[model samples]
Target chain A: MKRVGLKDVAAEAGVSVTTVSHILNNVQGKRINAETRRLVLEVAEHLGYQPNDLARGLRLRRSNTVGFVSDEIATTPHAGQIIRGAQEAAAQNGLMLLMLNTGNDRDLEDKEIALLLRHQVDGVLYASMYHRVVEVPQRLASVPTVLLDARSDDPAVPSVVPDEEQGGRTATRELLAHGHRRIGFVNNIDDIPASRGRLAGYRGELAEAGIDFDPSLVVTEDSVAAGGYRGSRTLLGLDDPPTALFCFNDRMAMGAYRAASEAGLAIPADLSVIGFDNQELISENLFPALTTVALPHYEMGARAIFHLQQVIDRAEPLGAAVHEVLHCPLISRDSVARPRT
Target chain B: MKRVGLKDVAAEAGVSVTTVSHILNNVQGKRINAETRRLVLEVAEHLGYQPNDLARGLRLRRSNTVGFVSDEIATTPHAGQIIRGAQEAAAQNGLMLLMLNTGNDRDLEDKEIALLLRHQVDGVLYASMYHRVVEVPQRLASVPTVLLDARSDDPAVPSVVPDEEQGGRTATRELLAHGHRRIGFVNNIDDIPASRGRLAGYRGELAEAGIDFDPSLVVTEDSVAAGGYRGSRTLLGLDDPPTALFCFNDRMAMGAYRAASEAGLAIPADLSVIGFDNQELISENLFPALTTVALPHYEMGARAIFHLQQVIDRAEPLGAAVHEVLHCPLISRDSVARPRT
Candidate 1:
């Protein structure tokens, strides 16, 4: 069967092809009453006249598609939520998502961004697996781009990232408010932005309480479960061990639980522990439910797409660099408790 | 910087535009020598001549793109890994991904698939938030399609899903080998394919072991932490509680753990438990560590793209139903143990 086109819709509606195109694309300044618009839509629907993206893209010089470039999809657990948000927002605005997986290779990212640009995508969403400052590839400069879960030192690029500093502070304050003073801080090496931001918050909270930060109480190691186990052991081995501990993320907090259990330390009796990023698995599986900060993963996804749509519609100027910082709520579950003197 | 095209590369390499096009696209039977191919590539590289996807897509009458349709990203934690796998495969084969989030709305799914078809995507990858079968919209019949992590009773469409039946059997057999005759099963409603398939495996193992399948030993509930907890309570409240239990999924197992802990049941000694879907958080957070099945999430993603690519290349005949069953591996941690007398 021959496919219906703009001409067909126009002919059926007794309107010019130009008017049909303007109405379909929602171009302003084409004076048409609601009655005429309704009639044209009805005619188009009856004829099954789906708008041809190829023809529309050619005419508008915009593909009505956005490219989402991410590092390995499997490694980053939170990224799926972000992608969903972006996809939903894009679809609502009649935009399609063209996704590229960089597999954590910088060279691949360069090539992928170049390919997206070659496709003339209306915008690009660059998501990194790790929360670190990534150097924006030069090829992406021409595209209206947004960074998700990763930040760039380059002020020219817009970024959407979790407020890790606030999350860390909230987790620490929750433990402190429960009347714990000698608290241990277990964290990954402060090389990544998230780690550094969290550590800074931990220290800030301690200073606010006029409690001097103890160097011996701080255990810096790997961020994985094994790393948390080792770090917890070291902290517990200290001559004057802390009554409570604050972990940077939930994975490490889980490791600390194992170390505590091996040592026969009853939770909230011998020690209290607070973690960040209330990973669903951790909150449910831990002996006592984990009291951690819940990162606004879904919101981040939704907001990024909303911003991208704004750039796509030209409602917001492209390359204006709109940086949005979202807050993580403190989910007070069962892990934390008062310090027994 | 005037954008370089085929003409510029041909002029620089002193060859016909058709020769350059053939060399670039790797078209066979062109009779181009190695020297000419090398020179043409070198000149194209020097000139930074990136093939415009828009023009190429128009010329080929194919988008060289695939649509990945799924529900909201936040609800489905497994999606990230799948997307990563698909992206890697797509990039390797020079295909781009068009992502559409349906938010689990049936009407929206129908509309988005229509939109993807209108965009002329080479194929579609329909992924579900969970392991359940939904009707594949009749409108999508014209497009080459693959279902990921979901199955349909219909034999017409190809599907790539994890081997949940084997996963359930593996978990149950592990407990049986540890000398547990009285084993209880905690599962979600049998409506879901994964739930039903897993329960079948559990029953099959018991039958093979010459053990009578006790209907009273199986507790079917919602697939959530709270549900697992409730289900575990019911099993333990019995006059003769089983020594070992197999949970349908990690979350359900976690709930069981809480119930066991509340009943002052020491793990392994008083009650042994095993779960499926080694969700990283679950295994790590569970006090004794969770010995569960690791779903082939990454492989499923890769396979979805592989199948779609096959359909697009016409290497595999179109409209031929292809069913690829992927396996899940048993990851033994600390959760399961020999039942004590």
Candidate 2:
């Protein structure tokens, strides 16, 4: 289990370590014979010799490392897909990620960035667990940085976020395609991009289908399961209740399920329900598996690295910041169906 | 927002960059007046200078980096806590983690270890997403390595894992304390350590209470909701069915809930149920919420780094590998109650 080094390869090939190093590194001016070069390579391959990346990186003035600094990302379920996506893309490009969780502490973030820079990382990824507006740290100004699952007011900084409006539209369109015209939208009361964008998408999609937006059918509450329960209860208790329910997230949809059951409405028979944020833990385990709109978390992570790499490799600063927004796909399960007559 | 360097501090302090470097780095045996040293330090502090860790690390032969190699840790809900624990602990010790996921592919794992070695990481954390027995990868022999949320068959390798048998005893004892003698155990069909350990704990606790082991009360199925439902239904149909049920996991406990509802039984009133692996998404959202056992994912992660640091700092090889077992605490919710007597 000893690390195979140049000396081992050279000794096995009956050549000096310098010759092996020069041949393996492909020193352009060296006049080594083709046979010798081939023999050194064969011996290195046979010995599974791995060149020291740190020494190579130092000589090339590139660390082959990207610093990934996140605010409470590692605590959320979505952390996995986003980090995994970035890691896989980085690995494919012969790079690794140095992860530092700041726990949303600005002071700690400043220190973390300083630490990342001290390690000579080629670039840093400023990531947020969920889509939000974030300010790039001042210390990060010197290094190439790209925001993941977040955006900034300054248009000149690159960022990658999920298209919330598009995701909302996709969810509503699914219900509409299933012949659900009278749909109750159980929305979150938060004044964030998700709430506003999803609501806009719901209204726009309803208008497209020649259905007037029913203000009474839309109820806003907390975003958790209890919030969904209260919202759904209010909607179902209306004098003219909607036939279908479009929940803000899977947790809310979970609450909506309870509301329907209490009202003696079996899913897709007496009522239908669709949700957003396809958290597989809830979406898959629900009695009647939940149908939800998938957040492009993994894609956002991958694309952030892709954009960051482009910025790092470019000689000139980007003419304009690339604010890329990815699409959300519909995950169809057992939740949605045609409205009952 | 520009990076502060020795030259900037020296220029501001009316001194040479070389003088600033020597004073700041505290190079021994250099002739310098106390006034000059004091002035250089003040200027460096005012300019917010940070010493280059990479250069310092090269001199010290320590990278201040730990390679975290895991098989699909980030893909699970538990990924967040475990990673956060390790990251927080590493940060406390002026270290960062270089994460590489292998997706359980041996070839990829081997390549990842090689990559970690090339980066000159002081040590590596070989982690598994779940508790299981794993063989130490041969490539990891060159680095100080510790297992996280997993154990090694080789007694000489250090590891930190949750005590599954203790967790089982805790869960069963809770139900027993609630005055339930006839407790049905809903077990997973998988022959993993969790299954074996939990079952053993259940039987041991029951025997301690002077109750005979009843094979008929235990039913094995898939470790998911559907399996829980099937297992619970079978137990409920018994001529003299148990008044309480213990599910192997929260997903299966979800299924048990459905079975109880179909049988017109209310939780804790008609049948008391307790689950394992307190996945908040499932355990918290379930009606009345589920009382379950929480696996010490975060603790395992933190302890693994703690043990790895010791191995790295020790002058001599460890005489005996430390295999630390963490405790699983019972999360009391509304799931269990005195057996409706």
Q: Candidate 1 residues A25-110, lDDT tens each?
A: 88988788898899989999998887778766866677889888887766656777777777777777888889887877888788
Candidate 1 wrong stretches, greater than 4 Å: A1-44, A233-241, A259-271, A284-287, A303-323, A337-341, B1-47, B233-241, B258-271, B284-287, B309-320
For candidate 1, the TM-score of chain A alone relative to the native chain A: 0.86
Docking tier of model 1: it is acceptable
Worst ten in a row by lDDT for model 1 chain B: B311-320
lDDT per residue as tens, model 2, A1-341? 34577889988999998999999887789899889999999989888787776667666767899999999965578899999999999998888999989999999998888889988898888999878899899988777889998888878789998888988888899999989888999999988888898999899999999999989999999988889999999999999898899999998998999898888889978888999989888898888998999998888889999999998898345789899989989999998889877
Best by TM-score: 2
Q: Quote the true-contact fraction of every model.
A: 0.59, 0.68
lDDT of 1 by residue, B195-247 (tens): 88899889999999999999989999988778888899999999999998898
Task: Provide the clashing-pair count of each candidate structure.
Answer: 0, 0
C-alpha RMSD values across all candidates: 4.9, 2.7
